[model samples]
Target: MATSESANSVSQVPENCRAPNNPILKLAFKILCIIAVSRESLDHWKDTKNKDWKEHVSIMVNRFQNTNVTAGLVLATTTLFLSSPPPVEHLMAYNSTISYIIAMISFDAALLSVISGSAVLVIYETSTAHKDMETLKHMPRYQVIALLLWLAWPSICLSVATCFLFVAIFIACFGSDNIVVNIITILACVAFLSNGALTLYVFAVVGKKPANGKKNTPTQVIDMHHASIGAACLPR
Candidate 1:
């Protein structure tokens, strides 16, 4: 519990939920995923181990099967195209197409993960704080802010990637083999680089557990918690 509006003391917690070092880290990490890789797959991976996954076995099973099946299709199609040798087969020999498909599908899963993960984290916090829904809702609005960020950030990133891909596609359409349909290729690289950097920044700030419950001093910790769920932490 908050001991007072003091700096040295620590805030109280319930018995569950893992804490990170800096509260702001989660927010940064969330954004990084959007820019870095298939946000959907990452989120799906996390969802695989969550409570709902266990409770809703049929839904979870179907989702997993479908995802793998889609991935398999890309692989099978590529193999078929590559086994023969010819003018058409030369394009098939380049495996980047399959890689690109995988990346695109993965992005779908990643988006879902970003949304679900943020929700889970905020709900967990409310539970840990032992506050009711209304009380928790007013506390820091973690879920609300996360939802907003989830909407906007992807649009910005997608716009950049899509615009670039469009240019590349137009060039390829003109019979310039060099352009190619490599949307996934470009996206995969961008996602990995941008998100990886974001993850590192978050780790540096939060380290392991979130800051010792900053229930005092302008409520920095609480705001940080909002930031953790994928919102901007600073006023900027």
Candidate 2:
């Protein structure tokens, strides 16, 4: 009776715990196990890649924090300039109103861009904080759009703000009664133009380098997995 009960209990064990009897079933189970193991390995690889991507994004966040601080200063300066305009009678008549209007519009646009970019970046960072694997793999349409706006919009708007600010300053200063200030402003403008020209020349010269004089085919799409290799090749 004991032997029979023990045998019956063994036969009643769960199908998953028991080895398969048929050769085909055994082969199928082996394949499933292999697939499961491969999937786990692939997930491990993806996790490593995700960590690297996060590090890159963290660096970006730090740089953007500095940019945002600079933009904040610009906003403050713009606000002060807008609020403390010269008295109506004292205002210069050389298209001063038009320049002020341009500066005001540019400043407002820049503020809006900065706010929107920050909000989008926050949302993107929050949503991907836990799981960026899917984001990296699928690259959803909305994510792409958000990423583009976050990366480009604020900087472009800030550039416009600075340009308009300088333009307004130049117009106002040129109309001023102080000869020394006018001469200094003129020299500053010349320096600015020369620096911009030199920057462009340097960029043009530096962009022509190839690997050991063998022209590398420009890759259309950059793979995050290969980003480390490319970074390693960069000058320290």
Candidate 3:
């Protein structure tokens, strides 16, 4: 009976009186609440960023697959041509051996870079896919930058290989005495250079990402809506 009475007394305590009367206790409680809320917010932000990152990675994977296929084709063609024995006259021609060597080396390097980069990307994605976002959040800034640059290596290497291949072809053509080959090579080089310039402009200007990397977040959108409503309410 005494225990029952005590329980009843505790349950019947006034709501206002239930709270700690000590100022320090109240302040500490408030601080703890703030900390809990901040932690939740940080986790939520990380989750959102994780989703965005995964989406970006998926896009990169698709591009890498395409590049792999294209590189494989180029590599195969170069390997087949290089495997065959060249005629003695052609082998002895000025710059012919050097040009062939450069072309072979460049194509091999390009293929290797693409394959290695893609493998690293796949391994990273597989490892991180099931992991907590906290791990990624704590990753060093320089490491993240390095990973981004590594993702870009395949494209850069491929571009350099292609340019070298073209250089090799130009060298071979110019060394020949045939006027037809010379004229055709010159025209092709002009077109290739123009296309390269256009590609640079497109990549540098049109395809540039935003500096701040801020997308249309919910708070920003809500603020914009409120501002528009406020402007509408004001005198014209």
Candidate 4:
């Protein structure tokens, strides 16, 4: 009777309860799964950010190259014109107001083109992988590139403005009688003004972060609070 009662009691026990899984092992496995998932997510996020960084750097490099080319062309053309003088009868009076204005335009345009080309070359050199990695050790590479690009924009705009001014000066001095020249001069003036405005806007707006009415992130707030407490505890 005792053997039968023991067999009945054993049978009454739930299958799950009879051989339950180890709670500690189950918990450890769950934790490991969470960690693995977290790690994969972090890796994916890093890859995405790196891709974006590379794309941005490529765009900045292309823009710098284009600017440098434009500046070089302008500089070359100006140099050629200065090297070859026309017959005295065909040339405007060297001492005349128009001549002086032309001289000023040429000087300014050449100077701006040289400066812009040099700056763009420097930026390109600095943005190379080795240099960028070195710079990244101190600060984010993207921020460094962003700042350099911001500086380059003004130079680019100035170079363009110089080109427009060169055309306008030419039209004013030599093409005054032609209606087409008058229209072109007006267009050049408009382009110059637009370039100046864009430069100003870039300086004022592009790098600035938007001020959304939001509080600091939890991590930042906690860090700040801890810093404040630590400061308070320090001996004055």
Candidate 1 vs candidate 4: which has greater lDDT? 4
Name the TM-score of candidate 2: 0.58
lDDT of each: 0.41, 0.58, 0.60, 0.51
For TM-score, the strongest prediction is 2
The C-alpha TM-scores of every prediction are 0.26, 0.58, 0.58, 0.41
lDDT of 4 by residue, 95-114 (tens): 34554455456656656756
Top candidate, metric lDDT: 3
Ranking by TM-score: 2, 3, 4, 1
C-alpha positional error of residue 4 in candidate 1 after TM-score superposition, expressed in Å: 19
User: Between prediction 1 and prediction 2, which has the larger TM-score?
Assistant: 2
Q: lDDT tens string, model 3, 1-236?
A: 85798566545543322324578855543333222221111223244344665675566566767666766766775565566553533322323678788778767767775686578558656755766644544556455335445655666566666777677767777666777777888898999989989976874676455687556789999999999999999997
Model 3 residue 151 lDDT score: 54
Q: Flag regions of model 1 displaced more than 4 Å.
A: 1-16, 19-24, 28-55, 86-236
Residue 25, candidate 3: Cα error in Å is: 50
- The residue-by-residue lDDT of candidate 1 on 90-130, one tens digit each, is 33323245434443433444444444444444444454346
Candidate 3 lDDT score at position 220: 93
The clash count for each model shown is 21, 0, 0, 0
